[model samples]
Target: MNFIKVYTLTALFSAFTLIQATHANAITAPPLETQVKQVAQWFTGLFDNSQQVATNPSIPLITLSSCSVALTNTNPVTGTENIYLEQKSINRFRLYSFSQENSAVNLSIRAFDTNYSVTGLCNRPESEHTLDSSKVLATSCNLQLLWEPTDYIGNNSPNGCPTSSGGKVISSVTVSENGIDSLDKIFGANGNLLFATPIEFRRVDSIPEPSFTLGILAIGFWGTSKTILRKHKQKSTVSEESLFNCD
Candidate 1:
């Protein structure tokens, strides 16, 4: 009877211990946010293809200035979209008014030769007619230039347009006075831009590890308690049986 009680207690204790351990581990688990950021920084540095994957701009003695991508598309055949950019005192460019004839087919495209230069655009030179198609549809599309918002606004004012600093033009792009849907279609169809380009950034928040650790600990405690209770029951049963047999 004692042996039976001991074995039962041992099994109960082990199960309790296992449960407790699992709970503790869960509570201690790391949050996904920190992990993601760490991974992003590491990978961004590794590829860093910003410089290597450049194309040449048209116009003599001109080079295309590298601009940060506000938006991009892996596929762009479904709708037109706008890419917005600001060049400090020069111009707030909007690559707007893109659209496609057909929304059903997937667009595939290659890089064209008529790359743009920052200064060349300021000069208002005619768009170069490249041997390459001006834009293509496909796996991804890049933004080289965009429409000028400040110019659009100033051109509309009852009051005169704002003067820019250092003789450079400064303009702002407003939420289109036209509804977003109409604007989207205009931008999309105007030249086959991406369908939806919202002017906001999506920030993912990080979670701390301590909370996870605590949760794990709680699970472990519950498991251990159950195990202890089971062992106690088995011991009581064995004791009762032994006394009955002795009598």
Candidate 2:
């Protein structure tokens, strides 16, 4: 009877451990590459269509430039969307949520002008799309962005901006590349979290400052000059010794 009881207790402990492990796997965040790819795929299609429209004399051309992600945060459902101009000026594009009406949604924008801190959540549209399960979840994981070229992001008013239909509600926000740079939580429906973090997106077309490249070249030239000088000095010394020995 004693042996049977001990075996039963051990089996119970093992079962508990297995159950916890399975739960953890379910909540575990997906890989950063996967997350970035998902975000990119969505935007790639959107941008392609937008760019074509922009070329049309009657429509605006919106091109996506760059994006990044953060790897850690307690909740991965929220973060900032940094917008860049023609691969030049960086700023926050105004945000609109696409979640169920009164489904406890929180959205905000932060511009680098004020250290890229979230200024405030834009006025809520009367109606918005509730995020389907396909979107991401959990914050401390991967964050992604799909950019649209904006000659005038503030005024151009992209087609997907928030509207009475809840245009682009943030289904899941991720901070996968860098941790929260800054945060400010405010009250919202269903005790939802309302906060903003500073994020940056470097444009690929933007010309890089030359100081770093120039410094590397300067060091290489200096080292070559020293090597030549040392060889010359050694040759002169050897010649002098030969002359003194009167070979």
Candidate 3:
């Protein structure tokens, strides 16, 4: 009787819990490369906030230009999207390296603004597509960006980075299909998070390609999600039956 009871407990526990453990392990976040491509497509094209500045006199007038580039970086990171960004007269180049653990797309930014040769290269069609990666100096992980469901938001990491004036400085950016809204959340003299002054940018160029791609990707995700749920439910049913038949 004791042997039978122990055998039943061991087999029943194995039957139910093992399948669940495997299923949980099977569930994985979507691929990072796909999200990176999505951001690249969305982030392309020129943007400006002239209308916002017109309404709010206190707000600064800003213009932004961004285009994707392919760099032969010495410290190459897989699945990184390189982009050239210009805001007013200050322009910078960045390699946006991506990773994913959940629904969010996380990235670490590597800037190469010090490489002057690549400056203004974003304008040339052929140049914007490739770069002399050997000339660009590798930069530290200065900031982090995250793609939320509807938009991408950026924030400086760890403690706020230092500045030339000995104060901390940080920047945030929100990117959507139609516009880019940026706000640098500042802290008061007392070290609390203060009000943020935003600089918004509306798209200056059209991106029909990305819009169509986004639609296709959404449909694929929906179908894939439904299939996964159905499979797991079916497996659970089979596992339950098997456990009952244990002798």
Root-mean-square deviation (CA) per prediction: 32.5, 27.9, 19.2
What C-alpha lDDT do the candidate models reach, one value each?
A: 0.22, 0.23, 0.48
Q: Estimate each model's TM-score.
A: 0.20, 0.20, 0.58
Q: How do the residues 188-229 of candidate 3 rate in per-residue lDDT, one tens digit apiece?
A: 335555334556667777753643212211000000122323
| Candidate 3 stretches greater than 4 Å from native | 1-30, 73-76, 89-104, 111-115, 186-196, 208-247
Clashes of each: 37, 29, 0
Off by over 4 Å in 2: 1-40, 44-51, 71-113, 117-247
Candidate 1 regions off by >4 Å?
A: 41-247
Which is the better candidate, 2 or 3, if ranked by lDDT? 3
The lDDT ranking, best first, is: 3, 2, 1
Q: What digit string (tens of lDDT, one per residue) describes model 2 on residues 1-247?
A: 9999999999999999999988976665444333333222222111112333334433222222222222122343432221111111111222121111121212222112322332221122312211122222212111123222211011111221221222221222222221111111221334333222222221213222223211100000000122323443443221110100000
lDDT of 1 by residue, 1-247 (tens): 9999999999999999999988976665333333222221211100111121132111111111211111223433233322212222212222222232221111111221224333333233223211111332222321111122211111111221111111111111221111111011111112332122111111112221222111100000000122323443443221110100000
